[model samples]
Target: MTTSAPEPVAHGVGRVRVPMPPGTGLPFSNAYLIDDGDGRVHVVDPGSPTAEARAVLEAAIGDTEVGSIVITHLHADHAGGAAALRARTGAPVLLHERERDALGRIAIGVVPPDLEAWGVPEDRRPELLAAAVVPTAPAATLADQVVEGALGDAQLLDIPGRRVRVIGTPGHTDGHLCLHDEEADLLFTGDHILPTVNSGLGLGGPTDTNPIADYLASLDRAAELDTGTLRALPGHEDPFTGVRERCAALAAHHLRRTEEVAASSGATVWEVASTLTWTGGWDALAGFTLLSALRQTAQHRELVSRRRGL
Candidate 1:
């Protein structure tokens, strides 16, 4: 009873959205095809490889060469098809150095025990411990340093005639990045500032140094950008404007959720998430949503502790 994949819709400047198959747990992660006006096409976040998505990619590019594949982060849904796409198109895959390490952890199913070891409280240890056992790994390794090193703030990525500035937006994932086209004022927000829902701030492993704080700061950084005619193409949902508003809404949502968690003196992460009022259904989306809630709680606790000098 597999659902069909959504059709790819062509956008201006040779960009197209190849939607992944539905009911795959991941709701529509888009594979963007950015034509460089030359014969080369730059694909961002090929998403999980599926027969349908591959077909869409082939159709979009046609005879145009796939210059390179750039990954937003190492999340499986985003980077799963990197290896396959590269192999298919003979295109070199690029990623942040930190993301390469994160990809390695995903490959081995090693969830870093840092969250529990560092800031997670003793009473909440049981639930955190259970979550730590869950494994989410990448399918393959991205061999080369696509963008050299960490793209701090912004770095120009020149592909044929198209130039995209790589902006480091690290709240969703430690090494998460977004592609900004200064000429077009378009930002390829890889799960950073989404249109529908805010990106999740996942556990960065057991050794993460205040990830929630880092994420909040990252959001602020994104909000500070002087964007004009701002159009953001997110990993999920349609492209839209108001990037700053979306980031602020996400921050506020987490802040309120954190306050709620704090108000419940004895509430565990699971309890808090279960009791929380969310927009989407709680069945198939539970794993991702719950992880987001837990990460939010973790960030909230850390912020409170810092304020109190705990």
Candidate 2:
């Protein structure tokens, strides 16, 4: 991975790509340091739970104080380092209020899906269940990570000089958010949108609303931004512009997948997922990959069924 020095995006906004732990299947996740127009800096998505990751973020913060820690979502690769940083700086941790509530209800670990219900073959069930050993929260998540505080939609952060407003975009997770800085024309999108990868949906655990539906609406909210000039600093990958076109492309991709799900109306999620496209082909999916594929297919299937009133 190319080591990046803290690169300035705007006058006080800088992007640091924190390397993810090996085996995460990705290169790195980004952590942004936004000068609150005061002496302190506000950190966004501090990245992996690894000490090396925290060190990278700490180096970016240097001697400057950390005013607040804002997480885009609770995913480890995104918010994992929050606890350590918060402890070090005594800075309050901020996330969507819904995510704060989720922390209270956070399960001890991820519960394995019902293999029979998803129609996984009996032989495949054991391997999939084994992968369920993963935790629902970051391994380093601490009790202090609890309160500290939270974020709200349309709320402007207490950055004295910058006009950073929170835009609630709840698709990737129930409380996923993107920060829009009208003053800087920059969007700190936390997995809400990416330049290349199609981020998986419904990762934030069970919710009453359809994650697919929530995601589409969330995309619409982001599309309303001044995309012509707004540069998006995504949770992963390099920073990029063309927010509007990228939004449309992401929407179209999901819509196409939805259409594919609709066409195979009567199929089980496992069957439907097999017919639809996957990065490595259906036959190659196993364990957690297979589980994720089926769950996503189920979400699309549910969306289609809901629309049909079936």
Candidate 3:
């Protein structure tokens, strides 16, 4: 039996959302193929489902060889197919060095347990934790330093006829990176800014610092870019216009969530999560909802600490 291929949306230099069936109850996460119309193709964030995603990717490439695979972060929905795609295409997988160790921890099954302490009911924790484990390996690492094989803040990649700039927009994940094509006025945003929903920014640890602060800074940075007729090819949504507006909306939404958590007065992350009305049903979105609450709590704490100089 032959399955139909995932539909591809043509953007400036390539296509996005090479499909695999939607799983984990979320809408389809996008997989982007960036080619200069040459035989060389760079696939970004090849989304989940090892076998089916690979088949769709192979179909997308047709006879063209995959030049490289660049991961925006270590999230399962984004990087789950890296190893499989690497083996199939004989292509090196690239990830930011800061995230390399985290990916290793994920591969070795060392990620911290879900924040059950915050009040997620016992019955729901297992599935959410299981889903988080799938993506965490790097075949190759993008170096740390800006010079000497490292990606600079807005450095243009040396791809012939393709002007892709690497923009370091950390926060959703510490090592998250977005690609901006100045010539195309397009941004391949991986979970930094989505069209419909605010991306979750979980707290890694106490000393790990406030991700919301970083996320806000990243939003500010994104706003400063030349966004004329901007089209954002996000990790989960269709390529849409109004990149800055969406970023502002997400920032405002998170700020409001943080305020609400703060006003709740000593409420735990799970308590805040349970109180709020999320878009999707709890059973379907329990995983993300709980994480979002944790993130909001962390942001609230950060705001309080700043007020007292603690």
Top-lDDT candidate index: 2
Which of the predicted structures, 1 or 2, would earn the higher lDDT when compared with the native?
Answer: 2
lDDT of 1 by residue, 246-289 (tens): 88888888787667656665444554445555667433334434
TM-score of each predicted structure versus truth: 0.79, 0.93, 0.80
The window of 10 residues in a row where model 2 has the poorest summed lDDT is 134-143
Best by TM-score: 2
| Pairs in steric clash, model 2 | none
- Report the error of model 1 at residue 253, Å: 1.2
| Ranking according to TM-score, highest score first | 2, 3, 1
Candidate 2 regions exceeding 4 Å error are 1-5, 108-111, 132-135, 139-143
- Against the reference, the lDDT scores of all candidates come to 0.65, 0.82, 0.65
lDDT of 2 by residue, 236-270 (tens): 88889999889999999999999999998445667
